[model samples]
Target: MAIICRNTIEAINHLAFRLDLGPDDVVVTTVVEHHANLLPWRRYAKVRYVECNPEGTFEPDAVAGALRGNPHPKLFAVTGASNVSGWLPPVGGLIQLSHEAGVPVLVDAAHLAPHRPLLAAADYLAWSGHKMYAPFGAAPLVGPRRTFAMGDPFLAAAGRSTWCRSTRCSGTLPQSARRPDRPTSSERWPSAPLPVPSQPSGGRRSAHNEHLASRLRSGLGAIEGSRVLGPGPLVPTLPVASFVVEDVHHALVAARPAAEWGISVRHGRMLLRPPLPASLARD
Candidate 1:
């Protein structure tokens, strides 16, 4: 049941190899991570950034004002939504101000798992797989106790049987990732997809992706240079859009509806945001 194919980066390498993180551990990302939850936790922890205002959103007093002029944080990664302004990161007031500064909050909810649903109170919650509708497989991180640990035997003598650790928690996960309630990543991958019901079915949690994102926000609100960023409840959104058409070329209006009718959508410069200006990042 561990079918975690939702916006993939193997959920930040399953939370940095289940937080065996080092190099003076100090992770805290936000600028809108899609680089698979920010480059494998920035190639193994030691990063701190949380900025995205000027109305792009991810505010909690602008991430506690960038964790008060930053300088060595413990951990505070975020993104419960905002794959180019579907916008959502207030996540219970940024997990109560990064636990009142004891600092520990990870959530990359890759475009908020196709629409929305996060049980809140987080220590971790990574995401990805081309943003949740599946076509890329595996990516999820929901950490705490032991900060993240599933077990790795050089990913099992390199037979690569889905890199073991009981396939990262087995069938019907979340009883602390199951297996008599956690027996170590289920002997190397395969089992962990059945805990999506704290209130499943439109009452909450990806209820068929918020009913196909409210039919893509009523068809991108009848298009025309569009306008819909982080509407309602901050970011429990889908039908994701970030428009400004006019002279066109937002990749040719998203590639002329995917070359006339194929329709897939998604343009540039949202690689967590700041990485633009390399000549508008090779448009």
Candidate 2:
């Protein structure tokens, strides 16, 4: 079963709430997740992070260890790919491992969706459409039917109401069924009349991205003061390379290109804030 959401963050929060998580419950997740995936779980449960190695990668054993340590983890929240390192985890095997341990898995595919086929085998999946060049404000949350069938809606609003008895009200089955008004985005932004650029096939795009990433890594490595983060391009990854130049503030590094060449570069923490694993370091 699936339902539309205002965005991937909302979808994640809804999933977290529906899990019936609490302070006593444990959630096993990795260190390399985006804040959207991590914060929602932290709000309701005690999160056990499976720390990454220096290369920003973790083995199934690490996750297994986390599960064993927790004894009865309610869920395993994991990223399909790292937005910072561009590293793709073995999500299929990870999902299987969690299932074998009697834990449900939620695969945060916000970054992975635009690059590769999704891990459909996972118990729950969530991703944003904007990453794939679709308009913002639309995301999808897909999961088992029974989970959402009987729960009180995450956002108790007008559209979700099934019945009203003076002061008491009931919500619809598949809680998000009436919540998202995604179609309104098109209507609201009709003035922005343009289509997304055409793209190559998935296989072709992936290959091109890999080649481009390799060249980017090589160029950055040659720069006298620059240091690229994560494993080398020889390691399979998406077309994302983060780097830093010695004796330069990241803001200055980001500003020079946009001012001089009209090339916008993102800098700063990229949302991997403090209290996170050292391996998932700031770029």
Candidate 3:
């Protein structure tokens, strides 16, 4: 079952509500996740971090190690691709590992949806329509129908009449308003079904993205003192690259080029870093 939400964050919040996560429950996620995937869990469950390599990559063994002794884990949430480094983690292997432990997996596909296909192994997928060339205000969470039925309603409004009774009062209620039958499968949620589009022939877009990513990485590598983050150029990734130049602040790197040559680029620690304690930062 899928539900339409205002954004991916909203979808996550609804999923959290459905799970009825409590203080004892734990949600296993990676250190490379965006804040949207992490913060929602903090509200209702304990979050366990799976450390990634310095370049923001992890394998299935690392995930298995994290889940070995944990007893209260309810879900395993991860991102399909890194928004900053564009690293595509081993999602299929990770999903298999989590399922072996009797846990469901949720995939945050905000960045990957635009560049590549998502794996069918994921239990839940959350994505934004704007990322895929559509207008804003269209984000959908696709998952099994049983999951949503197990939780509270995402939102309550009129016309969602499950069982209505007629009371003898001064005011007369119309019979059409007294719907006693249970809602059908399609009418169980607030979100409407998303339209399915035609699939691309032969995956031409994915091939093009890989070719461009290789060229971008090669060009960035030639610059002096440039340190590229995440996987190497030949590895599978989105057509995005992030690098830091020695002795240069990221803000200046982003500004100077756009002002001088009209070349727009993003800069700064792109929110992929894990949250640090204030005391640790002071040290």
Candidate 4:
């Protein structure tokens, strides 16, 4: 089943309610997750962060260790891709580990869906249409129907009802009449159709982006006093990269180029700070 919302944040908030998380329940998540993935769990449950390597990637052992330690984990939440470093973590491996421990996984695919296909093993997936070149204000949370039916409704809208009465109402509505009571998967999605382009076209775009990103990485590495964050060569990554210049604030680096050469780049903490060892930070 799918539940449509304004954005990924709203979808996560709704899922949090459905989970009925409390102080006793822990949610295992990675340190490299976006605020959209972390904040919701933090607000509703006891969050146990699985530390990622300096490159914003995690090994299967790390995830398994976290799951083993948390005896009462309600869910495992992770991002399909790092929004800042553009690193695509091993989501399939993580999901497998979580499932072995009897835990469900929620994937925040807002960044990954636009660039790569999602892993089918994920228990729940959330993405925004705007991230994939569609108009803003439409995001969907896809998961099992039983999951939604197991919890309280996220909202108290009139359309959620099967019948109404002025005084006391006595009987259940027929299944056909109660169609509006539970929204079908199709009705929960955007009204407009989303078509997938040919695989050849997508492959061409991916190849081109990879070429440009490789060049960008090489060029940035040659520059004096530059430090790039995330995994080394041959790792699948988005066309995006994040770096910091030695002895310079990120804000200044972003501002100077835009002001002088009309070049735009994102800076700051990127909403989530990955754990970096002292040795890596010193570099």
Instruction: Write model 3 residue lDDT over 13-65, tens digit each, in one string.
Output: 77887787777788888888887888788777878888888777887887887
Clashing pairs counted in every model: 29, 0, 3, 0
The TM-score ranking, best first, is 2, 4, 3, 1
- By TM-score, who's the top model here? 2
All models: lDDT? 0.58, 0.78, 0.74, 0.76
Clashes of 2: 0
Off by over 4 Å in 4: 157-202, 269-283
How accurate locally is residue 154 in candidate 3, as Cα lDDT from 0 to 100?
50
Per-residue lDDT over 40-143 for candidate 4, one digit per residue giving the tens place of the 0 to 100 score: 88777778888877887888788888888846588999999898778888888889889999999999999888777778899999988777666666788888
Winner by lDDT between candidate 3 and candidate 1: 3
Which whole-number lDDT from 0 to 100 does residue 160 have in model 1? 29
Which regions of candidate 3 deviate over 4 angstroms?
Answer: 156-202, 269-283
Cα lDDT tens digits for candidate 1, 129-202: 44443344445555654442333321334332232364452323344432221323332332333344454554
Cα deviation of 277, candidate 1, in Å:
43
| Per-residue lDDT over 199-276 for candidate 2, one digit per residue giving the tens place of the 0 to 100 score | 665688789878877887888789899988877567888878788898888999899989998988988854444565
TM-score of each: 0.30, 0.84, 0.79, 0.80
In Å, residue 65's CA in model 1 sits off its true spot by 6.9
Each candidate: RMSD to true structure?
Answer: 17.9, 5.4, 6.9, 6.5
Candidate 4's displacement at residue 249, Å, is: 3.3
